[model samples]
Target: MNLIHRAGWRRGILALAVASLLTLAAIEVLSDEPEIALLIGEPYKAMRQRSTASIDPAIPGHSWFNAPKSDARLRFADPQFGFVTPLARFFTVGFSRDQRIDGVRMSPQIEPLLLDDTLKVVLDLQEQWRNAGWVPIRAEEFPSFADTPQWRDRLREVKNVEKAYWRAGDKYQLMLVVSRFRDNKRPTEERYLITLGIHRSRGVQ
Candidate 1:
């Protein structure tokens, strides 16, 4: 090849290498950044506005409901949030009576998932939270069910339950529970449930 042609080829290769590096850097930054969409103390009106902007136009099944004590919930059957698995049946955000967000919860769509797949999904979520700076806490202890009647009831229906907890500095807490139960419709088969909850840390020891 001619000298000029060789130089042109070298420049082209350098340009491609630079572009690839930039793209990789961008992906790393996104992956490292926390994926929590709603801020803990953001006012209801502001959070609603921000969340509305995140709604994907092509996805459906979005609704809002009022929770106990005047708290509110925004639910999405197919959420756009990247942190949760696409298999999640519903994603819900809880807003307290004071009009500020308090927590978020999601459960995997159990009917279609095998027990192993459900366990993998739950573990993957924990890794994602850890990557976002949530430190694993209370790995050896089961979460207290006394405060949440729903969770207490869940314990009675399931077997081989496992729980994990994490904290992000002093600001946030995350809890994950995985369990399996016999399917009433199919007596010989088992069904799994994976529940993930993230909330503002209350300093509960």
Candidate 2:
């Protein structure tokens, strides 16, 4: 084809792409929703804040009955069991990929982690366990993970490394990824709960 034709075609294609993006943006804006996903991970390693998410007027909630927004900004204490990062940003949106936060856009392409929620937390824990320098011990019952204690403690890096939650039918189950502590194994994944639903499930022991 001639240069003129090719240039025209390129311009048209670019225009179409821009138009598509604008349309998507318009749609997203029109929707009266949070329009984001949240990320959640295992118990954050160090920081601890006792919080209960309840219907807050500060956030956009119901007027008469006070309905809570379907979404909210997500944050996490560092996974008590050290994962590569501490927070999950699937249901929430944090800073970056390493720090346990992405964005929950409408697309499945997944530009980053979503708001801090259940899925994000679980994924972060799985990653931390994967790289804790243990020989893989395959198991069938757990179905999602296995435990193998075959790493050297020369550097003393792992401080009570523990497994994360894989969703069971009605409840959550925790595992032990690594448990070599500095002083004592004080971190029990049992202490963590869904960052979003902590108030609702006030029984996280």
Query: lDDT tens digits, residues 1-205, model 2?
Result: 9999999999999999999999999867544333222223322111112222222222222112122234323322223322222322323222332332222111111122222332345445556545542222224322333222332231124333433223222222233232232222334322222222211111233
Off by over 4 Å in 1: 1-36, 52-87, 110-112, 142-158, 184-187
Report RMSD for candidate 1: 10.4
TM-score of each predicted structure versus truth? 0.56, 0.23
**Model 2 worst lDDT run, 10 consecutive residues:** 101-110
List ranges where model 2 is wrong by over 4 Å.
Answer: 1-16, 19-32, 35-54, 57-139, 145-205
- Model 1 pairs whose backbones collide: none
Candidate 2 lDDT (Cα, 0 to 1): 0.32
lDDT of each: 0.56, 0.32
